[model samples]
Target: MNDTAYTELVMVREFKVSPEKLFDAWIDPVMMRKWLMSMEATNKSASSDPRVGGLWEIIDVRGGKEYRAVGRYLEIDRPIKLVFTFQMPQFSEFEDTITVNIKATEEGCKMVFTQHIRVPVEENWTDEDTRRAVEEFHDSSQHGWHYMFVGLKMLAEEGITPVMPPASE
Candidate 1:
């Protein structure tokens, strides 16, 4: 039986804000923390530099377990496109790349995020495992982005930044 794995998950969302604002929220650490840390079970800390070749790291803690993701920016086109690599410390050998594209439209901004996973042939990869992992990742990614956009739209419209939950809370 062949045991090679490859898959891509794509999610698109429309935000009721300008592309510039949406892009800023994504790349800015302060704004990112607001939405990225919304989950009740998780604590997130991130450091990001938005230029090409810049570095980023996100640490998530849940149930006394920690997961760290490190990545480097590959391309940055302000308010339009961003490409970066994503890898988990525990799964360092498995590196994935994600591309985000934002476009201005008549109503708002259309944001598309695509994650590409490349699994080595030696992992004895199975279709069931791949599908489950991809589905879970895609769902979580979409939820986080949607939450962030909600906060962004609130800020853009009300001119008030939403309060983020306290880390210990």
Candidate 2:
């Protein structure tokens, strides 16, 4: 009966690091730039305000094209959970919500990452069209998150943070 189409993609990752450390990697701008930037990206920058209602932004340059993502923190429970809104303006105007739940474990921590994407329903589109759109978006978003998680796992286990670049004059 809902007019809008929405889907939730859930992913789980366990890391060999404490919950606090893993949680920081999610909000810390410098650490985010290191891992969130795709391997092919040559230049990347990130800025964040790690508080509820705060805003965050990241920009990555690949082949001289900039890909930017912006978000606002909706909920923040340090070392435990975080919920935020994520959107890439250049790609789509629709905003998606992402929730990260972290729990301490014997070895380290477990993270349950869930992304909720809501696609607006257009009057002109058929049911089949809406289904395909949701499926395609869900698959691509899952793949992207999987790639980012690989980097996050490496960063968390390594325990060595990457140095920040020198500021331009």
- 21 in model 2: Cα distance from truth in Å? 0.5
For each candidate, how many residue pairs have backbone atoms clashing (under 3 Å)? 0, 0
Q: Judged by lDDT against the true structure, how good is candidate 2?
A: 0.83
Q: Give the TM-score of each candidate.
A: 0.71, 0.88
After superposing candidate 1, which stretches have Cα over 4 Å from the reference?
1-4, 37-44, 120-169
Please give the lDDT score at residue 153 for candidate 1: 56
* Every model: Cα RMSD to truth: 5.0, 6.0
Clashing pairs in 2: none
lDDT against the true structure, each candidate: 0.70, 0.83
Best by lDDT: 2
**Among these predicted structures, which one has the highest TM-score?**
2
lDDT of 2 by residue, 1-169 (tens): 2357999999999998999999999899877887765532343788899999999988988668898999999999999999999998988788999999999999999999999998767778898989998898899898888777777776789854334321222
Q: For candidate 2, what is the TM-score?
A: 0.88
